[model samples]
Target: MKKILYILVLGGLMSCQKEKETVLKEDIQFLKIKNGLIESSYYENVESIKPIDGFIPNDSTAIRIAETILYKVYGENNIVKQRPYNIALKQDSIWCIQGNLPEGWEGGVFYIELNKNNGKVEKMFHDK
Candidate 1:
């Protein structure tokens, strides 16, 4: 009984959560910095890192870009909490980015990338 209890306890601790969080990229990318993961982080299958735009200021002098290291430290789906980050900006375009780092991620360096339409990163990175 004691051994069984120990195994169960360890198993529970090592298990992941199941939650649902959505990042539409277009719908919610306005002056917002998103930092959450989707279903999984599988290569080529990883969630996209897109840009968000908010009501652009009327002044419209220059854009500011920021970046932050993002990580999915816990959760499988139903609920997720990610670290705060900055956005990277250039020219008249704006963007928000989220990417996973290596095993020892304390948060990596992030730069701005423009987001355009439902296109791929390459296509979106240059959209104003």
Candidate 2:
């Protein structure tokens, strides 16, 4: 009976350690950074390293362009928190990404506009 009790306790401890390790690994996989741009999968798939061509704009392409332009104005800390941007392509090949601003800011939602043909930022503004 004594030997059986000791074995059970050891098994439980090992299982607990494994559980902790799994949690840590999961946390690490939640976020990733590339090309000095930090994006996380914890909330949404917000970053795309792959480059696209032509006048078509997908979530990855729009995000990559938007983040690049936004990064110049705001640091990674300010941008990463605004994930899962609401994106749309409007008339004249305009690709726009609208993300929410942090609390206590003057604006509520930030609008980032880009020319789909050349990936050039046309305008960036926010709703007051």
Candidate 3:
């Protein structure tokens, strides 16, 4: 009986660890886009941006970068329809921008941290 109880507890812990790992993996996939660059749709419409030679995007431009990918994934008028909030520049030229869910939405928020020098996203995640 003791051995059986121990086994059951161990199994439960392992399952919980696996679930945590899966959530992390999904978060990574959701944030990262192919080649870590803006898709063609943004270039087609936004003349200020250059895809090949990435620009040093500031607070406003960082929002554009986030929106470029968000618009692609969530469509033009979806979760990202509203502008990102709390755009701030951190040490080492890292720019952080957050997109919030619609009013009364259950989900918490999405964050994009990018480099100011080359406009490359260092990390992105959706928080619940």
Candidate 4:
């Protein structure tokens, strides 16, 4: 009888755990759907829903993204050497990130042009 009770308790616990997992999965799915709806609304042209704008909305964010890319392409030391990165938004859709060289510097700095709305790297190169 004790063994049977133990088995039943174990089964109940297992079932509850499974239920919790299912609920968690459902919650995650709901959140994804909700977020998708919000994103879709941004793209829609309806009067109620605002038109889609560029994604990398600000200079700070653009700088961070550009730095990350630069770090990957040109090692940390190289990126550090070029301090004070210049970031600008052009035509309301392009993020232009350029590395600034110190005074009397002759080497080329990193330059990256990315799409603000889609975060796509349109062009990337490091000057010599």
Whole-model lDDT values for every prediction: 0.35, 0.74, 0.72, 0.83
lDDT of 4 by residue, 1-128 (tens): 99999999999999999999999997666446553364454446655433376667788888888888888889989988887888788888999888889999799989999898888899999989
TM-score of each: 0.21, 0.48, 0.47, 0.58
Error of 2 at 9 (Å): 95
- For the record, the alpha-carbon RMSD of candidate 1 to the native fold, in angstroms, is 22.5
Sorted on TM-score, best first, the list reads 4, 2, 3, 1
Clash counts per candidate, in order, are 16, 0, 0, 1
Cα lDDT tens digits for candidate 2, 1-128: 99999999999999999999999987766555556555534547456454455554566878887787777786666677676678888884888888865567564656888888777778997555
- Predictions ranked by lDDT, top down? 4, 2, 3, 1
lDDT (10s digit) by residue, model 3, range 1-128 = 99999999999999999999999997766556668774555457555646442475457787777778766765666545445477888885788877766687676566778888777779887666
Which candidate tops TM-score?
Answer: 4
Query: Considering every candidate listed, which one attains the maximal lDDT?
Result: 4
Which residue pairs in candidate 4 collide? 55-117
Q: Comparing candidate 2 with candidate 3, which one achieves the higher lDDT?
A: 2
Candidate 2: where are CA atoms >4 Å away? Answer: 1-56, 101-107
Query: Candidate 4 lDDT (Cα, whole model)?
Result: 0.83
**How displaced is residue 54 in candidate 2, in Å?**
1.7
